[model samples]
Target chain A: MLRSGPSVILFLAWRGLRQYGLSSIVAAFSIALAGGLFLSTWKIKTETEKAFRVYDGGFDAVLGVRGSKVDLVLNSIFHVSNGPDKPLTQEQYENLKNNRAVKEAIPLSGGDNYKGFRMVGTIRKLFEDHEWRPGRKYELAAGELFADDRQEAVFGAFVARKLKIRVGDVIQPYHGLDFTGEDSVHPNDFVVTGVLEPTGTPADHVVWIPIEGALNMPGHAEGLGFAPSSVLIKFQPKAKREYLQLLYYYRNHPELMMPDILMTIAPLFEKFKAFEFALTAIAALVALTAAGVILATLRSAMNEKRREIAILRSLGARRATVTASILAHAGLITLLGIIGAFAIFAGIGSFAADYIREEVGVIIELFEYDPIFLQVSAGMLAIGLLSGLLPAIQAYRSDVAQNLTPTS
Target chain B: MAFLEIANLRKSFPSPEGGELPVVEVKEFTMQAGDQLALRGTSGSGKTTFLHLIAGILKPDAGAIHIDGECISEFHEARRDLMRANSIGYVFQSFNLLQGYTCLENLLLPMAFAGEANQERAEELLEQVGLDHRMGHYPRQLSIGQQQRVAVARALVNEPKLVLADEPTGNLDPSSAAQALELLRKLCVDTKAALLLVSHDQALVDSFDQNLDWRDLNAAFEQATGTS
Candidate 1:
């Protein structure tokens, strides 16, 4: 018998599906809806996890007053805390800096804001020594870093865009970090010396200043040179033993125990693991349900196409040909769904990127074409194949003679 | 050897009374290449079953059927499918054109199964059937006569050695039916393909080279039903 190749089969399948336009469209979009949800959730989880891993401001550990370690990581690394955590004294900061395992220790003093943007008091080391991500140092978009003792401030990219702050603009700092408009405004205005390019980190919304500027705020005067909000520490890679010893010594030391304990970022990431697993599980369930939808739609379509299958069989198509045609029909629809899902994700990313970055501290790069997406495409294709399996078998087993005869 | 041959062919189906009912019992039949025969039978006389068995669409319970030097009855299902695809053209009573396909696509459908399609030849056949202008029209868009003409065109597209016209004009009106029958016979003769036309119309049977009364040939039909 004459044997038709895959191209012919595909062409015929395409023609057949196109004839049933509404059902084909409905089936395709149902898969797309599931695929889109999976893609969005997967993308958000990946980006957020990446952001969390690097959000620590290049510090290995945080030294703060005894409190929730998760809160300390949240406040010190991400700068997102409801209320102030107790501070580390100047002596504690000096001890941390003097530790042999601590390669660099920088003081972070907060409790001030400029229109809801956090006013973080840090030293020159923050701009010069920190890497937002590995090997990526802070690059100024405009102006220079702040001096050691001055009212000058450096704006993060988002803060500048939101408040229209630029180099040479002066903004009054509020005495407290709240944005209720009731917080007393500081007497001195802080001049903007620089604006940093977007680092895709929480620093993008912070106003950086010399530690002394935070100290000199009206209520903070008495606490000047005595206490700091937290001390961020970077450990020497070769001094692991010394680092562990120092951490153990500090946590157990009677004099330094109350308000100067160290909290590493490892525990915070552990907590995030559970939350991300739940999100991924939900997304997988959505994909599975989508597969079910594909199966049901194809199986139902098989009943309608029984006569068509018989015609093909009568024309010399083997059972395999009919089966392959059904599979091809399903594969094409699923592939279209995947393409549609990507387009939808791109639209969502374009529309919600800035908002996601601002709120979730994770940047959404639309259609980055991650290698993992190849795996996702395969998963979708597998679903397509599986969903079409029963129907293909049904087509294979169709009673050709019965279907070919005209109904009375 | 005859171009088309059948001997001791037998087929049966299970009856509602829980017994085997013999449907076809043909002792011998032969037709030369390019010969045309009109077969007439009652509704339940197994006329369609004979066509189906000859086409290798159904395996006869006991028989030897040969077409174009191939013993199709002995062939495996797949080989039979291939033989049918390569050697036989069937024109069904209802036209049986797939709904979504254009007339040209319908004509080319068999070629797709054969893994070879000749678009120029298909167009020529369409032109021969007076349907060149309607090649792009869907089956549903055509008149019943026009659809039958397309079916006729489809039947000859593969240039098979045997063409089965199963009541090819059954669905058409009188004028259209006459036109369809004439077109089917003319095209079968033009292509040098043997034709077996099944119909209930005696006047149509007179147009063919031979007239076959199916009930008289099927001994099993009378024995099973006792309807001499």
Candidate 2:
């Protein structure tokens, strides 16, 4: 019982849409596909940048052997690669730990893996002092952490769940980053002492063992000597001058390299700029094609419904009423497309977030409200209305008498 | 004053060759309230064009068309459209019901345009036209006679002062045509609305109390054909 006004126009438009069911569905689906891809690509790019840029792993800088600063940070901080080419000796680690400007220094060593999960050896001070974020220290989910002198290990949450290891379970380290040969397995068995709670960082995929366990292993004492892979350092809160001095000092040092962690990670995204741009271009092209589909479908519908429109006019519908009805039809299709787009975006965003967390160890906020969603929706709505314009004009100019006449 | 009046009403379309081709030119015509008048004419003789002018579907190039003392010809196209929606109902020869809408919805459509859509009134009219059982059926689902009945119900849904029916039964068989005409005229009387019917069937026109041939009524047709 809609009165003659916008509501009536909307009612008639909805009826017209339902009358052209398959074409309407195809148009809406195309729009949804475009919108979903646009949103997913944008979200992945922005969220990945945010995650990497704001990464805080409880230390200000990484000091390693003279090598690629990116490789040093990626290996030492993110635990995603083989360790740096050369290791800093225990004497250098002790020197940095005892420096007047250094508040704390944690040594990290990695050479072996268990079931494809990298095992890192670090000091007890790391567990006791480091806060991954301000006021958020890691807590053990099961038993006690490994002692600095013992041949024991702690498992990260993801590794523990994946390998199904428990406290007191014994694991043997493999000689390489991946499972290579039966003879590559170390003879010593490290008892699982604890499992750390989920930290949503690279640490979630690591196995933590004491530095003594890594240094004293069978073949390691003869070939590697007493050297740690890298030393992660934090300067005193009021020692900004000394921190910059040390960074400058390491720039030309013959055997050492120190880099600001944030500076080192920011450039990684630069490598992805071309890939991101390609995805964005493809999304935009699909969106434009979707707009064309809407235009073609609506125009075809108007052609098929010309006689019906004339009959409506003969029943006293004003030209504006019929025209508005066509616009309303387009609006409804766009609305459906936007809703479907959100569903598709959610599905894809969740998958991307999970993949990044598992493979790259970065947590992406998938459902945060980004203005791009609103902006894209508005743009699509405007395009939809524009697509309906020609058909609306055709309806406005329809000849009531001629179209309403009997064909016979 | 007459319920419907037209004075020197003229309308023309652009001719394919050149110049304007006069379609309808009625010197004067009037119908009183509650009256039934039939207009008879041959094919392409300006009968439908004259009806279109009266219904305000087409603007008169020069003249005045007044319905119930209001001059619609002088009004703008939008205002004329509003006047038509609120004061006049139309039925076409082919039972031009919206194929998407049910019989009941078709009856309610005119009322919606009139800004006074009443579901109860639409149902009552459908019942009156013997379409109560077919109210939920779409036009394509209904028979020819049923569709015509739905058209008749729609015409009176707004209780307009004038109902213009253009060959409302032309597509029906002889028996269905006579029945449709009787039902339409009966409903017009029941609603107290004036009826102006245009048809080529002389037998149908003979049933009306008053009837006029289009050749005599439209001076433009007589001039164009060079006929009396």
Candidate 3:
């Protein structure tokens, strides 16, 4: 027995939940699963969007051969795969470097791998001039940068840690993106010159060599004359007019394609909108079904406890008291389920953040506060209380005299 | 004025055949403070219905049930519930102790509804009923006689001015029934509470200071039996 009205209601509600323990647990678990799925999906969608929006890998655009802008950005900016097959000629590279609109242009050539890690060919200016983020220059953890016209390589942090390579060790480059067999290994053995510190960017997964070494490698097209895969360009600040003019100039050029990094990645998220909607719809359906289960379970428990409820009324409990007790029961279950949902979300969100960082090279902050957490919890709690309304009404309207009839 | 009073009390339930089946219709009844009365009636004789009416568990179609000058029948349902909780104690025949609560919790429940739940008073009542040792036991864990004792303790926990017992010993053996009746009568005398007991057992009714038969008390019962 309790003293206050609310305490009595809460006590009775807690006892009622304990009375039907298994059904209560099953209902709460269903709510947890639905909530976890919704939270995970929503977090992934929002965080992925944020990651792409803020991703500026030192350069503003990629000038490459006429083809898919998305592929060019993926290969040149994110190091996702081997560079494009059609390479930009030395004349095109020199023209872009000498353009007044372009502040700097670094050439990138990639068609080979050292044990599945992409090996990119670029000049020393890449390490000397580029800052991945504002005021954040790449620094070496060991040794020094590779010199031009040498069969030497500088490994990214991830590549060095993964392959266990040191400054003095040498590696044989494989001719293609994937390592098929020993026969695919090139005769060119590049010594490890340095290992870059972790940058938390896609560059952390690359191995860099000189442009001359990549262009002059054996079995390469020698007479085509210094054709790198693509040129990464940085535009001067406040050069929006010149940038748009260059974009328009390249739009009509049959042999060239210039893609702003942000513009190329923004449309990809638009394509994902449909998939996100489908996932949200499935989560909403599951939530509705969970609410239904709460209703059914409580209604059945109410029916079983009719006699007990009548006994309460006989002992001077008001109709409002009994009704509130039922609603409180629903509230308890919903609160427990919401707590469990948070735990489940943490597990799933952490796993997803790790997967995305490792596979896509985009960092997602797992613990960032979002308003969806509050909205989903409050919404589910309201639905749970609403689900208990019918049974509460039934309890309120029960016939005390009839139910309390002497069974003896 | 009497501690308990009833006049022109009428109650009816919907019959299976679509009309009204009269249950209780008493023209007049009265009891003094602390007076003990036994009401005897066979099955379906409106005995339990009369008890329900006085306890305010069921509303009468027409009546003035003045318990300690409150005229509870004229009050709203919520007020009647409060009136019952504060002034009238009820002991059911089957010992309707809540299965989920312990013996002490059962006693404390009524006091809680009355808004003055006192743990000490509940524990003292359990001691008076000789159930002090069983205070922590649920109804299922107690014997029938012990369960009845707990019910008696629960009814008196609020120290109401009146008690309504509907065959309180109906489930007990003869020896246990005698002992339970003795304890109930002694407790009522000690608390200065009027007792209105409804039972069909003549041997049980014979010991009361005053007794009334349902046919003599309830005009509706007599009319239903064609003996009015």
Candidate 4:
């Protein structure tokens, strides 16, 4: 018995596709276009969001040196591009840590990039703060984390993915601020201890070493004196008002160069939320338009297959059977197209990480495809299926008898 | 009771200008199992319409058709579909063979749709039509007679109790027409299914067991058997 098993149905659906080979290819292309755009934007957005959200690793506030809040915000939070413009000495960090309003403070030292990425020199408290997502904890694929403190280093996922460095691999570091001189590009060789699992964020593209490691380096990076970019301060939720007053008052202290400079713009989170809103809105509009194109293409294809459907009906195919066949065909085409598009993007993700960072400021790791890829792909598929529903229903509802009668 | 029976069958359509237009007004008709019957008519004579009505493809404005003791005309659209799948097969005049399918694919179509892939039965039926060697070829590659032979093979794939064909060989050459008729004759006996062929070809009509004219079929409802 030639029963239509899943494989048989797959074969039949595949065979049915050959009748309108060109149309089927077009359908796939449309689906790929829709799925690809959604995925590329979705992946980049998700990873970038994940990167920015990394700021929430528990430090609600940062009590920097007497001045240069922006520099403090840049370096201590993002671990890059923030100059230690003001030497926020160790006493201030200690003072904030011991304050009634302060919960915890993690210090960061951003020195140099072995390549285009920053080398974050921080403590274990970094991972402890955020309550890292699954598998975010460091695992030793070969050697241990930077236990020795002075020169030992830890690697991020991208170190291996991009630089092809392995545990025990020694790479030269460069001076952070004085990036001009050739000497700045190659500071000293440090052995790669452990490789961090991909966070799908900026961290994935960075290397980690003890703050002392950068502090011991040459002129700019290894701070000659007190090289604190900023002091991260976490305040208890209820401590905001009084602490804000204290922060304002402290800023006014003559020691802070200009203590009167207490600026209140928007909450960092508000800025992020608004940015999120705008990016997602653009993505949604583009996705909707892609969906419309999909609908038009599918509806037109169904019209072309009307006669074939009629023939199937006259051959005793039930309406549901006919409908299923059409749906299956549409779905298969959309699926193939989506996969192709995804493959293209996956290629981009792997091969163009540095280029993307250079071009768009998206510091995503090329090691792992973002996990959100599946969610985005599923959404694309749903959109495609919904797009096809109108034609499928039309094919379903039409009278079999009328369609079966061949017109002269 | 006849193997198939229709009573008080009336079909009407809304005229393009507005009111109702009466199409076919047959009050009664009956055929025994295994009967080869021809429904003859001119263009728009309602021969195809009557065939569709009996095959459960169309609902009469008012009437009933019983096939193998099942009153199909009264069945809902869904049941009619099931009835068509399980008990009836149609051989469209245009050879309505799916162009997407090969010759064997066409022959196997009914069995495939009927959810019974019975390869042995399909092969035997194909042999019955004497075209077993042409299974792999698509319908387009086959001659008109060969394609018609395939249509007949499909009609018997499910061993249906009733086979409805519209102009079964209208496009075929004389030889193909005679051959298709011969296949249809053997199909009725082998499957125990009554065959209803609708066509304008009088020669094909004379070849069947019973012949009925479209104008004569609408005689007084009570005069059906008498006219027969």
lDDT of each: 0.79, 0.87, 0.87, 0.68
**Per-model chain A TM:** 0.85, 0.96, 0.92, 0.60
Report lDDT (Cα) of residue A12, candidate 4.
53
TM-score of 1: 0.91
TM-score of each: 0.91, 0.97, 0.92, 0.73
**Reproduced native contacts, each prediction:** 0.58, 0.59, 0.43, 0.46
| Cα shift from native, residue B35, model 2 (Å) | 0.5
Tens digit of per-residue lDDT, candidate 2, span A263-319? 989989999999989998998888888889889999999888889998898888899
DockQ of 4: 0.40
Backbone clash pairs in model 4 (N, Cα, C under 3 Å; residues 3+ apart or in different chains), count: 2
Which of the numbered candidates is closest to the native, going by highest TM-score? 2
Question: Could you tell which candidate, 2 or 4, scores higher by DockQ?
Answer: 2
lDDT of 3 by residue, B61-164 (tens): 99899998889888888887787888888899888889998898898878888896799999999999998899999999999999999988888888889999
lDDT of 3 by residue, A201-273 (tens): 8888889999888878887777867889999999977777877788789999998999889989888899898
User: All models, DockQ values?
Assistant: 0.53, 0.63, 0.49, 0.40
Q: Please report, as a value between 0 and 1, the fraction of native contacts recovered by candidate 2.
A: 0.59
Model 1 chain A weakest lDDT span, ten residues long = A257-266
What is the TM-score (0 to 1) of chain A in model 2? 0.96
**Interface RMSD for each of the candidates:** 3.4, 1.9, 2.2, 2.7
Mind giving the per-residue lDDT tens digits that candidate 4 earns over A333-391? 77877787787667665555656554223466434755676786787778767876887
